[model samples]
Target: MGIVLHLKKKEMACVEYSFHVPSLEELVVVLQKGLKGNFADVQVSVVDCPDLTKEPFTFPVKGICGKTRIAEVGGVPYLLPLVNKEKVYDLNKIAKEIKLPGAFILGAGAGPFQTLGFNAEFMPVIQIGSEHKPAMNGSYFAHINPADGGCLLEKYSEKYHDFGCALLANLFASEGQPGKVIEVKAKRRTGKLNFVTCMRQTLEKHYGDKPVGMGGTFVIEKGKAKTHIMPAEFSSCPLNSDEEVNKWLHFYEMRAPLVCLPVFVSKDPGFDLRLEHTHCFSHHGEGGHYHQDTTPDTVEYLGYFLPAEFLYRIDQPKETHLFGRD
Candidate 1:
């Protein structure tokens, strides 16, 4: 059993900080120093799209931009036989696999025009009137798709807020609970906005309750001795009580680039959700390592849902211009 940390009720101040790349030492210092009071933790935030530019490849190495393509769900690739509705299209079974006792499934749909990106071989039947016939491609989850779908998935993530509801709806549906899932109604065009707060509340609406008692994910030990506290990596815990939610959010706000949303994994209500950033645990030979400064520079901010605020008053000034006139 994991050690239980209680989330206590507390008020907080609104706070926000912005900066660019700094030396590793400076980055660590800035990150570590930011810890105190309401700042229990911090996460690195991406300012823009990640650098994926590449030269014409002769041979690809194993790393962030690897050559091999693997689209998996529960160790099963979507591109393989599993893609067939007749063979692997069992929604209830997939729901059982998720182990969510009282799952709230949503179906995110789209018009024919919206299904254009799936212009590839896998979805051979995904052209005009595609929206009329709801296939698994655009209607369900888009992640781990062939080129057309994968490209759309990446673009959707850039404005994830627009598709927040849809993402969750399809995400759950893709996992088998295709029915009863929720979808965000508004349309999104560019990367200028987000709906993280709304999405969090939606998750809570369907999953949270007074019985769960707040708790999200606690740190898992790693490396030889596992001494490091794990820096700027994404992780989550959907705490039970109001206090737990606030505490966990605070823990990440000051420490790394994190965005917390209400998530319901099982009806047990007591299931303490543990979140591990996929990238944090993924790597080829080296095995999932992150640069202290650069990793964060690529992530665009996902509007956070925090109970309290930490608005710093710099009008009076401090030691630096950040506070006002030094």
Candidate 2:
């Protein structure tokens, strides 16, 4: 005998889901998974407690060349058209034009005409010749290409120069200001790990919903590492075909003790801002744009980062064909 009962239908209701804050171990696991099984023993810890603002002042520009716009950040003038096509730039002159009593600036871009010999001390330059080659400070001028490599030139007189090239960089200038400090360390392991990706994920999880910008130096404590260099200088438009451009991308594997300058953003600011950008210049006379560690049982990374209260995005292209996307 079967018993039948009247049943009432229920309506489904939407529920908001809150993401749980991940612990350090949990965050490490997530980062390991993101590395696709390439694991590196990771450790993350806050070093200093600084009174840092939750929100940072953002200054964004769409294009640099062809426009006569000069913006000042912290009383430092940032002229966009100074590094346009067919334009000559003197690093000493630029420093004089933008120098403040006490300030610091950090950005990346292309510069120094490859064909013309310029007296400048810059390294890890990637330019296209018969083949893609990674050029360093002492030997950069030897490799002559119509276009130069993307580089970070500071406003210091120790390394100054004039160049006929174009650039797009965010110059952060400010007096002494405190920023939140964090330190990350990874021990030698058998597999590779993407340092930038790991740092980005960790920062995002740490900061939660708030966007943050960080700049600091990192060192490849030991073992072999890998980095890439842009084979051709960047412009508002492409100078080579997609196929050729792809061929021009070059990577280098080098020994340890490579010091790097990392400029990272925790969240996209709705502008054409790179979430993570790092460039390395080593005292061993080898450096370039950092990629990942590729050493087996001998790879280590030790880095300290400080979150900034301001981020200036300069010279964004109106329509960029970068990476073959419009």
Clashes of each: 33, 1
TM-score of each: 0.20, 0.56
Candidate 2: clashing pairs of residues = 62-316
At residue 21, candidate 1 shows an lDDT of 19
After superposing candidate 2 on the true structure, give the runs of residues whose Cα lies further than 4 Å from its correct spot.
Answer: 1-40, 48-101, 114-166, 170-180, 189-193, 205-209, 231-244, 322-326
The TM-score measured for candidate 1 stands at: 0.20
Consecutive 10-residue window with the lowest summed lDDT within model 2? 62-71
Q: lDDT at 100 for candidate 2?
A: 29
Among all windows of ten consecutive residues in candidate 1, which has the lowest summed lDDT? 317-326
Instruction: State how far residue 260 of model 1 sits from its true place (Å).
Output: 11
What is the per-residue lDDT of model 1 for residues 152-205, given as tens digits with 9 covering 90 to 100? 122222222222120001111111111111112121212221222222233343
| Alpha carbon lDDT at 97, candidate 1 | 28
Q: What lDDT does each candidate get? A: 0.19, 0.42
Q: Residue by residue across 1-326, what tens digits does model 2's lDDT show?
A: 11122223531111111122334344445444543334456666655522222211111111111101111111101112112343333322332233322233333333354434332223322111112222112112211123544333232223533322233332322332343335667675544336766566655766666655555556787887776555443333433444654454455686778766566666654445556666666545465656677875777777655555444333334544334210
